[model samples]
Target: MPAVSSPQPSATSQPHHRFIKISRYIYVFREFSKFSIWTPHVSFLQSLRRLAPIPSPSFFQTLDIVAENPDKFRIVGLAAGSNVTLLAEQVKTFKPQLVAVRDESLVNELKEALADMERKPEIIPGEQGVIEVARHPDAVSIVTGIVGCAGLKPTVAAIEEGKDIALANKETLIAGGPFVLPLAHKHKVKILPADSEHSAIFQCIQGLSEGALRRIILTASGGAFRDWPVDKLKEVKVADALKHPNWNMGKKITVDSATLFNKGLEVIEAHYLFGAEYDDIEIVIHPQSIIHSMVETQDSSVLAQLGWPDMRLPILYTMSWPERIYCSELTWPRLDLCKLGSLTFKAPDNVKYPSMSLAYAAGRAGGTMTGVLSAANEKAVELFINEKISYLDIFKVVELTCEKHQEELVATPSLEEIIHYDLWARDYASGLERTSGLSAVPA
Candidate 1:
């Protein structure tokens, strides 16, 4: 094609091209040989990851992937769920062996106990991996001094053995932060979050320079009572408090939601999880619950994670962070649906819900304020369910509990002292009966 006449083909030039082809083939053979040596070792581990767990159609169930590779890891489930059935299907697709199917039968237990609210009994709905309690070589014991059940000892043992934890139980950290965080550091295992708010903050802050993050703003739905008049709150029943208008959740969380106490717990979590100080975090009530949480940079710009009021999205997010998976079964949000209404936000009313302030107080005080707040709320909610106090009185008991423990907070006591304070708060709050619907047992 060149205008010049082509030179006669030469055997000497031909040998150069022939040599190049041979070189490429040799390189390919070397790679194939190395792969042969490694593939069996990798596949053997993959089989172990698939060990007793049946897939839940509702969750993304992407654990087997993390199982296959050392780098792929994520949280399973916590909070309540919206698309549990779909997540189960996704898990089957990924074909993970271990799944967290937290007693589907307890759905009736939750619904029966939470008859006043629209709490549907179902799986927490995210990771469908079976957490073999003691099967792994490195089993960690997870415990928190408060809450309905004990979780820390098992979590500690598991972490001690070398298994990284998928942490959902906040009270464990509340009571055992000094022990747990240090031990996790010593062992160098993972402590993944199961709380939506903390998970959101964790995702947003990833890879950001320290100086870039000005602060974190944790959002709350403000519960069903956000619109209820403060004057009339005393007459509110446990049934009324259980009704969260947007998200379907459990009785424990629903009660915490009503008081915005769960949000308070998240504030404490963000402090410990991210190492931010007392003033660095703030809370704003976003009623729709679409905007799960946000973080602000020093430049004044804010980053937020948005989705439907579905816990599975965040659960899957924790499991599938850094790389988003394609789930054909999951629904995508329409711009038309999202843009139809203004997303509203307001500062949490300090007068109506003082729990947020106490949370900040507990977090600032460190030691065991988080443990105390969790235990007190549990005790107060129990009293509400027993008809000893009206719904509004839940906050009253919690407030007095905090006030009574003011000295403990100020002193910044030891972890042992904090656990003692947590137990004392629970027992003291439970002792008094509902004197008036307007208020409750003072610590």
Candidate 2:
């Protein structure tokens, strides 16, 4: 880890006198002294209403930012789940030309949201709906948000359509990198990374000439169990495992953080995203998550991207690549150096978090092996979440499944071949849960 440079300004130069108030997506600057500020009673209640944390607003924030410059960027298509009624209503606000949803039951609800529109958008439903949205003639880019190997097929479809990809789903690259990468190259479309860490690496090396880059340093939050001793990990409960220290994410991902498999998956993703060798891409546990990721040049200078851990910026960067758009709605404060206290980095303990090593092993092995690794981890995470398996069993399942797939490892696997290995590994991992012994859990 390189020495972290402090970003603090001198007391005279810094604006510390004004008190900071942050709501879900807005920052309110006011005088620190209550007597100096004027507030109306009705406005005070409205401010209180805005204080509740917004429900996962990364995608919506991107939309809102794009909405500001409707001419420069258009929200022509969408694919989303949950709050379909609300999402559709919002879509009506943007009034995209097309909309897609996985839940067929919500189609009517979506229609109701757009009932008032004079020119209702085309509604596409189910799996084909996802592909249609990706391949829509009006669509210029695809945002892959679906989880696991499920995202790979649609991502491929979007790539074939020559749609630039804003890759939020890590599994697309993890399970199907060999096929996806080639497809992207053949189509000559950009597969922009939307993950914060990967986006940070992308931002760090954006203009720098290739080959001058020596290594990619991915920072990890070290997850829920980072502080636990080696022996304590086996006893970790599912609820306990879901408690990630830094990021607010889905259960599967949260558990992945606990096992360090999230970082492991990122290791493979970074390998494909940046074309860095598995040996060259390294994971360092940075608990702060302030510095998203770093790049080491051939001359050994390290360039890093630092910000508050907000997904909106990264997602926005992908959508507005080559142009940094001003996103006023995402009004979070910038990283203040003096308040940071410290940014720490340490090499991961491979013995405790064997998933990290398994990722490297899978990357080194290549082909369907990485697919198998991801599938196995997904299955293991599901079982662990269901409480059918213990926390440490996550690593056990991934390791066993990957070892079993060594015989099935194929170089340059086709899409179907990758899916085959993915399913095989998932089943293998699930089967291991029944017969796996307590002794199999790593120390």
- Taking all chains together, the TM-score of candidate 2 against the true structure is 0.81
Where does the lowest 10-residue lDDT sum fall in candidate 2? 37-46
* Lowest summed lDDT window (length 10), candidate 1: 32-41
For every model in order, what is the number of clashing pairs? 43, 0
Which prediction has the highest TM-score against the true structure? 2
| Pairs with backbone N, CA or C atoms under 3 Å apart (clashes), candidate 2 | none
Compute each candidate's TM-score over C-alphas: 0.67, 0.81
* Model 2 agreement with the true structure over 1-443: per-residue lDDT tens digits: 11112211122343322211111111121211110000000000001111111111245555454445544544556666445865666566666666777678888988887788898878887868766766766554565766777667777887787766667777788888888887887887667677788879888876676477767788888989889899877677777887877877778888888888888889888878777766567788899989999987867679999988777667666555565655454475667889989899887787778887788778878899888988899999888787788787787788888888877789899999998888899998889978838333222
Report lDDT (Cα) of residue 409, candidate 2: 83
- The digit string of per-residue lDDT tens for model 1 on 1-443 reads 00112111222233211100100000000100000000100110122221111111122222333333333322222222233344344343333333333345444443344344333222331212122322222222221111332444445555566544444556757656756677777776556554567667767766676456666788889998899877766677777878998887667788889888888787776666666654666788899887778977766668987767755455444434454645434343433554658889987777778676667666666665567667888888888776777676777677677666666562444445655777788987786453443453222
Candidate 1: how many backbone clashes?
A: 43
Name the regions of candidate 1 deviating beyond 4 angstroms: 1-135, 138-149, 329-340, 406-420, 434-443
Against the true structure, what is every candidate's RMSD?
19.6, 12.6
